[model samples]
Target chain A: MKKIFDFIDLNAEIQWVIVIILIILITATLTFQIWKKVKPSNLVDEMMLRTKSWWGMCFIFLFASLVHPIVTYLGLAFLSFFTLREIYTLLKLRDSDRTVLLACYLSIPFQYYFAFQGWYTMFLIFIPVFLFIIIPFLLVLSGDTTDIISSMCILPTSLMLGVFGISHLGLLISFPEMNTGNISGKALLLFLIFITEANDIMQFICGKIFGKHKILPNVSPNKTWEGFIGGVICSMIIGYFMGFLTPLETLPLILISACIAILGFMGDAIISAVKRDFGVKDMSDVIPGHGGYLDRIDSLSTTSSPFFHLIYFLLLA
Target chain B: MKKLILTLIYTVFWRSFNKIIIGLKYHNHKSLRKKKQFILIANHNSHMDTMAIMSAMPSKYIHRVHPIAASDFFGGTKLNKFLMKYLVNAILIPRKKANSDKDIDPIEVISKLLNKGRSVILYPEGSRGTPGVMSNFKKGIGYLIQKHPEIDVIPVYLDGIYKTLPKGTSIILPYNCNIIFGKKIDFHSLEIDDIVLKSEESIQKLIKRE
Candidate 1:
């Protein structure tokens, strides 16, 4: 296994991560297949659909990561675009909000461009500082100030969460410090994504099996104390072993993963609240079983920036 | 050759645009390619509606499919006429014929296309109505169905194109849209009013399905 990974053009860490993901996917497929044969239920069918989507997602993620940096940038930008578009669709913004929404969509490419150029300062402030003011101004220019406050609130937050937060993953690749030895920025990205997604899955499983006390019944009825604690612990354990992917020490790595797990939960809860407020079960049915891009990336959207900043502060800063 | 070029462009451009930008999903899309000739009726909102329907169609059937667009709207200028005729493969029929030409009938134009084994997309609403609101379908569709009872009428309910590129807006916001192709209605032995009522009800049912 080591020899084959080493022989591959990709760094051994990324190759190993890919192998681990494949093993998990295959095991899940087998487990689901067995579960279906044993007892056919809607849960099994839903899980099968989710697993199929995961396979496609894994392929796309692997392709984006393994290809040149431009592909990764473009892929991330497209994700942001889709996320923002999904949010706008869900918000049901008025025709007056169209111009502002257009401006918000246009900002995605610029945000990713900054990441591609490795313009850290500009990337950090571009959406938050620049578009923050420009969006509302554009809304004002539209001359339909009915529900302007909501537009002001939703547009900037959408950009911040969808574009600004997710663009960190792109900027992470441009860091020269992240490309140390065999573990490049791609490995770190894969590590972040794996931990974030694994934490989500862990929380879900724990909640299903051992969940009793509701955490936020109003926002998300499914989340529980058991899920949160169990997920964080499980994430920390995974992060400790996956520490080789990053340049951080063991203590910092464990702490960061815990933060990621907690933040990931917060992100999921917030998005759930937004969906519940708007009376939507899912953002959209873009992905077959996963709901939409926003549904799948809610955790990652909240985790990406924090993960990026933490790594930067610990290693680069 | 122009038709072939248009097919190629639709296969590549409109398909990709609908799939990627619009995220156009379909329900009962297989039924669309099952028939060689049919009247595809959908609620029109944006110019993207025609493109979305065309993109949903298979490339082999694209050349034979003509969306019945209004000449006054789509054929006002020479360039619009050329593009509407060639690029979109749309058969432009005048919404209101000139006083001099009393014989220029829209149904006759559509029947000619059907006679050639070509499918035509008709917006029974007659024009683009308010976004997200279904208007009363005009009687022209009923008249056409009465004349050609042999052709099947397929009701397609298009959602979210108005939000993507609504009327009075050229800038397309990338909002996901869906095309729901209802089961084909055989208007055989049905009156013009019955045909109209059935098709309208079919689309209304699709809107409720979500």
Candidate 2:
């Protein structure tokens, strides 16, 4: 406890950043609530409730960040469980794919276990390579070759993004703090979370205000060019100041911020496409305001892996 | 004491076991809870199907639900009868026979239960069928609804239960199984044959969602 406080005292700037972000979020919620009263719109109510849920999520995340890396890893494992559960609940799974689904769900614990051990090679290749082969073998052994093509394609795709992709956040937190006066893994995880979440919020706010051109109307109707540009710029500015949380210099931080924004946008669209294909309005109504774990962390699904790789090669290498 | 123990076993022990092995997904069209005495018919595939329905049912309705099991299969011995009567809360009726005098009619037993404001779960297919293919519903369901036209018949589709624990298999395989409840059908104006066909049709429609 004392050590955590001393670490907080040392990284007081990051502490201040969290406080400031919380204040801004609260102020935005209040302003939106008032705006909702003057002009009652369904969109405003959804946005207001979404903002409220964000406050709850942030506090939970802040507590996790303050705790040990094990807490962060377990928290992420829990997140992966919820996300995969939602995916399974909505996915059009075949009878033969049942074993494959079980294997996929079981792999969540193994993936996090690898992350806990800091077994990077196992963590990275387990789902994409090993499960990629194992899932089909299990399917074939079931002796039902019907819908094999679609099942093979969809199972691996869902497992990769839904389970393995989200597990990278836990892997990111397994990195050891270096000797060059760097922050701990929890701080880096928190930084990635803040940037990605802020980017999403900023994009929503900007799109609502000045969103005329539909970027991909078929895939994601709400995404707009104006919103995307505004969000990227704002997140870049925020990410530039957050550079102190990592060992990156000015140029790398800006580049990382841009990567998060763009890749995060792509992630959001990919999930939206899947949801649209599935004819589901939301993944599941598990969370009160946010639809599901998938809905809340769609951007993180895309951003986490690339962001981790960028930092790994640029600084850790 | 029996109802309490059965409810506990179903809720705690069977539910968790089946839930882990066969991931059950439920899609209820309307609030089936409010209807106290409707006939619940599902495509039978495994012994677990009745247990799945028992677990998914609201606890208040647990005691009221009497799943109709085969007398020969479940009531062959005194101990089996005790288990069926107590643990399963089952109404053991004889399987279909050509002679009506020797065998007690299942409709009479089911109607008696329904008149007492108790829900009865019927497997219209008589016994578990092959996993994917649904068999023709027996005329018993139509006759039950015909005799007691006031009762609403709810159709249920049980998906993937055959593969989970098919007949002649003691080992339970972990598979993704779903139980979907279709809308309640009113047989007041329909013929008995139409009632059976429509009831089968409603259940067949739910399989499409799978």
- For each candidate in turn, the TM-score is 0.95, 0.77
Report iRMS values in order: 1.1, 4.9
In terms of lDDT, the poorest run of 10 residues in model 2 chain B is B21-30
Q: After superposition, how far is residue A273 of candidate 2 from its true place, in Å?
A: 3.2
| Residues A1-317 of candidate 1: C-alpha lDDT, one tens digit per residue | 25335557877667778888999999999999999999999999999999999999999989997888999999998999888878887786878887778788888888888888888889899988988788889889989878898888888998887898889899788876676664377878888999999999999999999999999987899999999999999999999988878877889999999999999998999889989988989998878888988889999989999998888788777
Best model per lDDT: 1
Model 1 collision count? 0
- Pick out the ten consecutive residues of candidate 1 chain B with the lowest summed lDDT: B94-103
Q: Scored by CA lDDT, what does every candidate get? A: 0.86, 0.79
Write model 1 residue lDDT over B1-210, tens digit each, in one string.
Answer: 866787777878888877887777767777776687888999988888888888778777788888899987888899999988888988999886445666588888888888888889999998888887889988888888887888878889998777888888778878777888988886545787888888889899889997
lDDT of 2 at A235: 91
Per-model clash counts, in order, read: 0, 0
**Alpha-carbon interface RMSD of model 2?**
4.9
